[model samples]
Target: MPTATIAEDDDGIRLDRWFQRHTKDISFNIVSRWSKSGVVRLDGAKAGPGDRIAAGQTLTWPEELPVPVATRPTEKPREPLSEAQIEYMRAMVLHMDAHAIVINKPPGLATQGGTKQPTSVDAMLDALQFDAPSRPRLVHRLDKDTSGVLLLARNAKAAAFFSKEFAGREARKSYWALTVGVPKIAAGTIDAPIGKQPGTGGEKMQVDTEAGLKAKTRYRVIERAAGRAAWVEFLPLTGRTHQIRVHAAAIGHSLVGDGKYGGKESYLTGGISRKLHLHSRRLVIATPGGGTLDVKAELPPHMAESWQMLGFDLQLGDIEIVEPPPPPLKKRRLSSATSGNRRGERRSRGATDEPKRPPRKK
Candidate 1:
């Protein structure tokens, strides 16, 4: 019998899920058959396929069963990366530590692969595994057209921790965008619920107040350009698919170059590139052990050009709003003597300090 101990990362997961993750050669039917035949045991006791697994628990199976060859369609083998491709991935690394890697993802680069997308950051992760025990895992994804501040976990433990933080909405993220028009309300929250649009095969999202997932975004206008475009900062309070884009379009101020959501109105008249202008500017999240991870990414080329064309100040720093704004500066209290003296002066100036009596004769 070959016995394996469950790791903490696999704690509380179903036995079938554990098998799927660790033993890829073995199918669920084989696991179920072995469990029924008493060939699969957990800590010397017969176990079923649906049983939950715990950390440090021993799982044993009979060695007589031969590993079956996969009959499912195999994926196309990935070609090796050239030296130039390796350097390209390395150059995108904005911040790298023991547990995390933050990259400045460029516009038009897909975070993960799709049927249409062949080259993606996920495919190139092997190039990023420098001195690490395994290739980095993606904790979250950036839209293929949107760029900036994509985080990667270096190992399984870090991946689990980061994934939980993002799922719980504990991670704070800020995005910079150039909207087609200035928002009527300069700074406010968008509390529109979002849902996938019908007939689009869930490829597009829309604001469906009646039946949609809760999606909220806080936005502030950093600057406006002659009533044409505005530089805005958006903080998503709740993560939803295409939340920012949908909310922005819902408010009638779609993002510049966001033709899918904004339609013809999304395009600007200037020489700006039609690529999406949304960028994940900053991210703040707690690390695995103790401290916090804060990172910021610079504006991509097309956005930088548009900013310059609009005469926007590049020196203006980011408005940090991860935490709540500090309380307003306290006002100095007036001393009692000073207050009295002011009242006396008002009286001398013919402003009566007491209420006037009316209609005494009546």
Candidate 2:
């Protein structure tokens, strides 16, 4: 019999369910057929279709069934980094201590490997021998299009520490975005609860009060441009998936170039730019040595151009603070006439103008 052992990642699922999860292209009917045929067994005994399984359970299946493929090994031949890539990495590596190395990852480079892509930031860091061991470990991740500071821990211990710090919200992260419109208030907080949309291919987040997680984002408008756009700063208090992007879009002003959240007009045409305008401008953390660690990333090429077009100079120091435009006009509450006819019904019921004539028909 072809024997297989359940992995830690497969804990808390059923035997038949585990098969379905592992075999991507296969259907549940196939899994049931295989189980009924005795091709699949658990712990040298026949496994029922409904049997709940724990981790480390051994499973046996016929060799005729194709083996689930493993995660593609990180080791693969890659062309040497281009001159530009090398320079990018060089600029990103702000501080390298014995415990950790930090990098300002550029936009468009993925942090981890996926099915289609062979190389990733981790692979590149390994190739560069940034860590003593053959493999360098990623402590955290940034979105594929997000250009910002990323942390790498040289050892597993350091990785665990940094991971805890992030989970505990001990690290401070600040992002700068050029949004399509200015917020009505100069500074305010968004405390909307966020929940993932169902059946939307995992691409949308909605503000839901009933079944959503607590999400808060503190934002302040830094500068506004003739009602065209505004520069804003964001500090997310919670790290739900796509929290910043979704929250910004929920408030009506999507970030420039954010095609996922922004409407059609928010997209930029040719010769303008193709990248998202959000940037992880700064990160502050407490070091193991009790010293405050602060790092900042300069604006990438696309944002730099956008800033220049808005009449801003890049030679200025970090954290450019600009004067904001006037606040947007607040939406007016509708009068009773426009709101609805509820009051009209009440007024008509109370009127006594010659209504006694109707009693004769009764």
> Using TM-score as the measure, which candidate wins?
1
TM-score of each: 0.77, 0.63
| TM-score of predicted structure 2 | 0.63
In model 1, which runs have C-alpha deviations exceeding 4 angstroms? 4-16, 24-59, 64-76, 315-317, 322-362
Local accuracy of candidate 1 as per-residue lDDT tens digits, 1-362 = 77788776566667876777766567788889999899898888989888877778998887765432232235456688989989999999999999899999999999999789989999999899999866799999999999999999987668878999999999999999999988756665677788999999999998887799988887777778978998888889898999889988887889999999999989998697788999999999999879999999999999999988998775443744333453355843344422423111111111222212223465
Report clash pairs, candidate 2: none
Cα distance off (Å), candidate 1, residue 331: 20
| Cα deviation of 199, candidate 1, in Å | 1.6
Best candidate, lDDT: 1
